[model samples]
Target: MIPARTTARTTRTRRGAVVAALLALGLGLSACASDTDTGETETGDESAAASEDETEVSIGIPSGWDEGIAVSHLWTAILEDEGYTVDSQTADVGVIYTGLAGGDFDVTFDVWLPYTHASYLEEYGEEVTDLGHWYDDAKLTIAVNEDSPAQSLEDLAGMADEYGNKLVGIEAGAGLTQITQDEVIPTYGLEGMDYSISSTPAMLAELKGATDAGENVAVTLWRPHWAYDEFPIRDLEDPEGALGDAEEIHVWGTSDFEERYPTLTKLIGAFELDDEQLFSLENMMFNSDEYADEQAAVDAWLEENPTFVDDLKEAAGV
Candidate 1:
């Protein structure tokens, strides 16, 4: 009882200590708020980058067609430049169409319509969408060496043995081969000639060898092909139209393709490649020793046609 009393000086000191502690606690709370705000800003930045990364595209390309390869790579380059991740798959044309219908692929570049790929469109047209035609004047042709006497497929029957009794053709699954088997051969009386079914490069090799050796050669070819310019070959006149009418090379995609990529759909729809442009681009990619490095080939092409990228971007409204 005797020592329980506190002095005024002691009371003042305790009040001062309590005020100092409150000030320290307030400073700590302010520092915590600042840290939380900085952390939120950093998290938002990371989220934005991840969102950009999530935008992607998957393209299916027909294995034997150089045109498909060319445009697929070109699109991949363009999309990558715009910060999209792109995947390119090489498969047979039939497989590509099926994949598109099943949603396994996002898009494809080389769909020949009205004649070529007619059957594919019939089978999958309901599930897929035709983005647009990029090139017209596409057709199947039977070509001969420039000096050959055969001016048309009608003349090939009698002169079959003169050209080694054989007609060199591309892939067996190709629409061209189908047309030749079902229509062209019977219409032109070409059954007497032995038909050879092989890959495009193999057929091209045969054509080049025969032409280089000064021998007569007959080949199944198509327009917008580089062989016409690279080798001296002339397409036979198709008076009967058995090889089918002129086609439009189109871009095809899944049903939801436009909804998923409105900008890209516009860009692809606006794309145009005439005979000269397609031939040169294909020649650079397919006929060069440097083609194993496809990106390099595409880059070389873009360098040669410098305005193409700007034109595509402008068309896409990017």
Candidate 2:
């Protein structure tokens, strides 16, 4: 009887041990399944978030230049087509450079280089990388109404006595304005004349009024600008070269930003517009009746010029 009882206890102990081992194995398998499911769900969510984050960038431009705004919007729309959302802001050129240096702005397409923005470039050129020239042979020029007797910039120098001893200029801080103050006026020996540095819109308004009334009006002008098309004006010859030689409009961004956003960078680097294309775009923005909004004008241009868009994309390797 004692031997049988001992054998029975041993058997019961063995059964309990086996049951515990099997229960532990089942729990281990369930934990692994739970971990695998959690990992897969997390990865899927992360991927979706990353994809959503890639569709946008921000740009900066100068204030009140409707033409610049339209061009910027065109580029933004092009980027949108390539899976990017774009935001733009308008400020002074100085502010734009500051913002870009701080990484607040991703790009600027309106930098007139080697002259207009020489100081800015000297200060920040090393910090930023030049993409390429967008428009060429751009410069500050003096223009007069087609009917005016003042045939050239030199003609205006003697007529200052009749014209209130004033040379009408654009915004006070503009590169053209500075050139007029530092070089143009001095070179022309018009030191005693009063200079009127007005805002861009104001200057345009003055020109329109003067031209419509058939009076002599001279103001700063540049190529590829809408003012040239809207008004029948001629660029006054620059004998003294105070306005400097012809320059190119450049595209620029913060250093290494292209590497950070390779696709956007390449697209920006590939951007280039000839005189005709830019002039057309500017004219549409400033003179078109089809659209009142600058951005709408840009959209229309893009719709009409799809081939150019493809070329830009191809150049960008997009």
Candidate 3:
């Protein structure tokens, strides 16, 4: 077997190359800060933020995507606190990307790259500025309960009957659902089973029911999800490369956004979040019943992560 360290090293190298190419196209880091010797950019962003422009900002959040919604709200609170009017709306990824390309939406924080959203970016990349990616290790997977009969998609394809002869899915318009319908099912010859296109909530309900009853069920899922912590489920290995590789979650803005909101652009460019921080924020915003209002959820999250805004401000030099 290949050494695990070598495999990890190879994966990271590939990820770095993809990130570099994306930066070359337009990560817009030059608009924010200078590159350091370590290839990481110093994020103070004083190069542009002399005065914060007080303008109305429109942000798009992808429907059924918790991460997008969380970040959209998080940024909304931050930007509004910085004295800007912010409008946040929810829609599908396709609609958001199309609107962004046409200069209708000002910013969106959940564009997945080099894999899940390659088509959208290919069509709209030139029309938009990639503020930068905040999170890496985002991936799509077909998950099953811990006690399921199959350990991988290859195993499931042949034993469809064991998983109720079906595969549960999320929102019909979601990227994960589309990719599973178009690429995954075909690649694995899973056309024999019933593939149900439903909403994320519906899929979660099904998952909860199945797992609680000790039944077998497979559903489309993604990493950095709160469900993994709540449910006793695991991702099925994809040996045929049907599902794409790990993706970086990026923030996208209209091509002229930098000119329109220089300071905001710089601040957005300096954003970064690891899995733990993101998962915690998302859990607070989504899973917690105590904070129904998105802004309130953000406030509660800030209470827990007291230095979040302060650290980001310091990094952005605002």
Clashes in predicted model 1: 0
Model 3, C-alpha of 67: deviation from truth (Å): 0.9
For all candidates in order, the CA lDDT equals 0.75, 0.67, 0.77
Q: Write the per-residue lDDT of candidate 3 for residues 75-133, one digit (tens) a residue.
A: 77666554466766677777788878887779999988888888887888899999999
Predicted candidate 1 versus true structure: per-residue lDDT over 54-139, tens digit per residue: 36777887867778778787776656555466776777787778878988778999998888799998999999989998888887
Q: Alpha carbon lDDT of residue 8, candidate 2?
A: 11
Per TM-score, the best of the predicted structures is 3
Q: Which portions of model 1 miss their true places by more than 4 Å?
A: 1-54, 290-292
lDDT of 1: 0.75
lDDT of 2: 0.67
**Higher-TM-score candidate among 2 and 3?**
3
The candidate that wins on lDDT is 3
Model 3: what TM-score?
A: 0.82
Candidate 1 positional error at 204, Å? 0.9
